[model samples]
Target: MEISTCTEKMVQIIANSTLEKSLKKTLKEVGVSGYTLFDVRGDGDSGDQSGHLEGDSNILMMVVVPLKTSQNLMEALNGYLKKGHHLMVFSVDAEVLTPSKFG
Candidate 1:
């Protein structure tokens, strides 16, 4: 199989459930279309984020987007982080199996 040069990335977002709305809005504004969300459980610098309960939970979101869109989302995320929202974002290469689906 040949690897395509799509410049796409799998953006992973882990944050408190409270930040879900803001995260969704930013992703939409940054041109991200599809994503997979999971109620996750983990501990971090802030504290235990076991998404076992409604209020005390965490959200894990993964989205595939072009590099430009990822950059934009990263920029917009700074403000939320500054406000002390538990957030983390990472971008990695995305292998394209169906290019048309992304366009």
Candidate 2:
């Protein structure tokens, strides 16, 4: 048996839940093939997001994409931050199996 794998980037964005619809639209426009969004709670400059209220909560959006696509995605996300949207975005190197699935 053989295992096939490739390197990519796992981009993670933590932002206000109120931006879910807009964020999803951005992801699609940025050409992200797939992603995962989770209701999450955390403390930050904006204080604690308890996840008890949809509008006041936070969401963690994660996506694994090819290196080139990652750059485009980052640029799109940065646009949100520039607009003063409450968002935290970062990316880490990832070793992904079946990389085409992420492309």
Candidate 3:
């Protein structure tokens, strides 16, 4: 059983709603339906405030998927992220305790 994990963060953007929709679409396209999201606030790599000064919101999302589905989802998100979207993405190997959770 192969597993993959992904962590993504978006900064200074009101793209939560759009991001959620895009994520869902990508997940469905890749046959994945499970994910988790959290609200986050922090400074960026340049030591700039992450929207705190401008009263914006930041969100972090994590997704775990079977290896077979990970590539496809990544491909879909790549284009979305390239459109000047302020975001970061990283992936790692993972093990799922509850296999049924993905279903």
Candidate 4:
């Protein structure tokens, strides 16, 4: 059995419908059918916001898959990130206690 995990951070202009669409397309291309996304707020070198930056939001997506699938996902994401779009991708070792949950 093989296991792996990857996380991708994407920043989309506020109210941009294409963000979700792009994510779905990328996920499908990478062979990752399942993922979870959460809304997040933060301050970076760019500046600080009193509360949620205006016209900007962050989406964090996490996917856990078998080693082979994870590699494919990362390759697809590389092209996206190279466009200089506001995004980040990272991966690390992971262990799934219940394999059925991923299936």
Residue-wise C-alpha lDDT for candidate 2, range 1-103, written one tens digit per residue? 9898888899999999989999899989878878998999988799989988767799999999888888998999889889989788889999888675645
Model 1 Cα displacement at 103 (Å)?
4.2
User: What's each prediction's TM-score?
Assistant: 0.83, 0.91, 0.64, 0.67
User: What order do candidates take by TM-score, descending?
Assistant: 2, 1, 4, 3
Question: What value of lDDT does candidate 1 attain over all alpha carbons?
Answer: 0.79
Off by over 4 Å in 4: 1-18, 45-55, 100-103
RMSD of each: 2.3, 1.5, 6.5, 6.3
TM-score-wise, the better of 2 and 3 is 2
Which candidate, 2 or 4, has the higher lDDT? 2
| Candidate 4 residue pairs that clash | none
Model 1 residue runs over 4 Å out of place are 1-7, 100-103
Q: Residue 2 in candidate 2 has what lDDT?
A: 86
Segments of candidate 2 deviating more than 4 angstroms: none
Query: Local error of candidate 4 at 40, Å?
Result: 1.0
Residue 68 of model 1: what lDDT?
74
Give per-residue CA lDDT, model 4, range 10-100, as digits (tens).
2222212236568777887767767777665566643442334544665567777766776777777767668756555677656555452
lDDT tens digits, residues 7-76, model 1? Answer: 4778899888887887888888877887899888877787787666676898889988777777887888
Quantify all predictions' global Cα lDDT against the true fold. Answer: 0.79, 0.88, 0.57, 0.57
